[model samples]
Target: MPEKFDIHQPDDRFFKSAMSDPEVVKAYLQHFYPKIAAIAYLSSLKLENSVSLRPSLKRFEADVIYRCRFQGEADGRFYFCLLFEHKSKPDKYVAVQVGLYIMELLSSMVKKQGRELEPVLPLIFYNGKEKWMPQTLSELFQEHPHFIALEPYIPNFRFLFQDATRLSPAALLELVGVLLLERTQPNFVLIEAR
Candidate 1:
């Protein structure tokens, strides 16, 4: 395994490389969250195989969003927003970052076509050093004055995290080992090998 504090910035080439190898992505996600592997596979919609990690923004930035079409049952095209944030310790700022990304995605879409569009799902794949549990209304209210209670409206399918920091050492090793294995590529290999 590589060093723990790998603050090295992965370039566009790296992104393109992984995008080319759908197996790498599937393995990475499976390692990140084995419990939700099935759901992740379903939601993947065979997207990595069809699309590239083409960033819309000129400036290289965090929360890079990628667009892809679903080649699965429905064949619906969707945008997968990938937010990369690395931290030495756990914090509550993840919500703010994800919130900003979601806002940016909708705002950009509306601005492009000059019209309102339906909500797009934002699946955040977190490779950070913390476990992200979305802040609740009560928790947020605690920080502010109690004069008016803020009823937070958190929508479903808004955000999801691939929590690496929270997983046990054994689990983490198992996941990484799975990801590193060349033969155990994507779903087919997973099904057959398992």
Candidate 2:
């Protein structure tokens, strides 16, 4: 028989522990994905009371599990599944990882809804050393010699908030704290690289 290696997944317990300190959570979320700060805040409202963390999956493990209503002031309901994966080190295979996450979320949704499959939009929060540069599959074909045309609608957004001089004492302290928190995990690595 083949051996099955032991695998671990972050649970609601981790989420609860991490979020026990509101300031820490707020700073982490704000620095990671500013656009989603409001949304994360809204979702965290019910986190302790209703949100289920690390919901069972068929295969891959999700880092953070959350459920929040995307309520429209007039429309009333827009339910979404916010799945988070915390990475301390860069994964060269991030695209594949994200793709898998989307697939899993869709499959779970299909079973939950008990209906035909529908396209789902997923938001991925990446917190790793290497900057996430998501490019279209077609972009891979750009060869050197000849000039490849540039599209007006290049869809790449880079988020860089890590400058030594710019970081306040408090921010630096918090950053170090997060690093220390994840030190026990194998994925932890020094992110002091330029």
Candidate 3:
């Protein structure tokens, strides 16, 4: 008998393994993460050991973190957290989850080394069949008389989102090519030739 394959379940293992590879991660960021690529060099990105907020909390299961030095800036560092969503349905509270994870990362750094809060860029990669509509934390909130008045007091944060299902075939092919080249050649520079 042939083995059965499940499509609805989240493949956290496969996503984590691919994102953990230095070359694959670098290529991914260079091609998909424009804002981050603008501030940091791909060569400077170093994958950090995944940190757990608590033993009871398994939020870090589908997430990967990277530490990188800011280009042309002394004493500048950035934390990039990539959270993968592989389920068929999108979570309505994904922003809240990401915000909590970011706070946990900051808290961990402060407790361990007393370092100043570093800027963290939270990115979400969704490959589900459903289209992701929400873009910011504020979007998930219900509009009410009091809520409208207190909007300024609420903590607002936005995460970069990429839906693989929406990408064109040519663009997907380009990304694949880039990943292959990067994997084969460690020193491959992604910058276009002058």
Compare the candidates by TM-score and give the number of the best one: 3
Model 3 RMSD vs true structure: 5.3
lDDT of 2 by residue, 1-194 (tens): 99997545343345435644444444555665566555543533233222222355234555444444443422223444444445444455444555566566566566765444433333333344455544332343345334245433333222222332335777766665663454346565556648
The predicted structure with the larger TM-score, 1 or 3, is 3
Give the runs in model 2 whose Cα sits over 4 Å from its true position: 1-34, 39-58, 71-77, 114-170, 174-194
TM-score for each prediction? 0.51, 0.46, 0.77
Write candidate 1's Cα lDDT for 1-194 as tens digits: 88787645453334444434445555655655454344443345243122222256434234334343332323342334343333334456555655555566565666765444434444444345445665533454465664244444433233554455677877777655544553344454323235
Better of 1 and 2 by lDDT: 2
Model 2 residue 98 CA deviation (Å) reads: 1.5
- Provide the clash count, candidate 2: 0
- All predictions: root-mean-square deviation over Cα? 7.8, 9.8, 5.3
* Local distance difference test scores for all models: 0.45, 0.46, 0.67
Q: Mind sharing the TM-score for model 2? A: 0.46
For residues 150-186, write the lDDT of model 3, one tens digit per residue: 7787778876777777889878767666546655666
| Model 1 spans with C-alpha error above 4 angstroms | 1-21, 30-60, 68-86, 114-138, 152-158, 182-194
Report lDDT (Cα) of residue 40, candidate 2. Answer: 43
**What is the TM-score ranking, best to worst?**
3, 1, 2
- Residue pairs in clash, model 3: none
Error of 1 at 179 (Å): 4.7
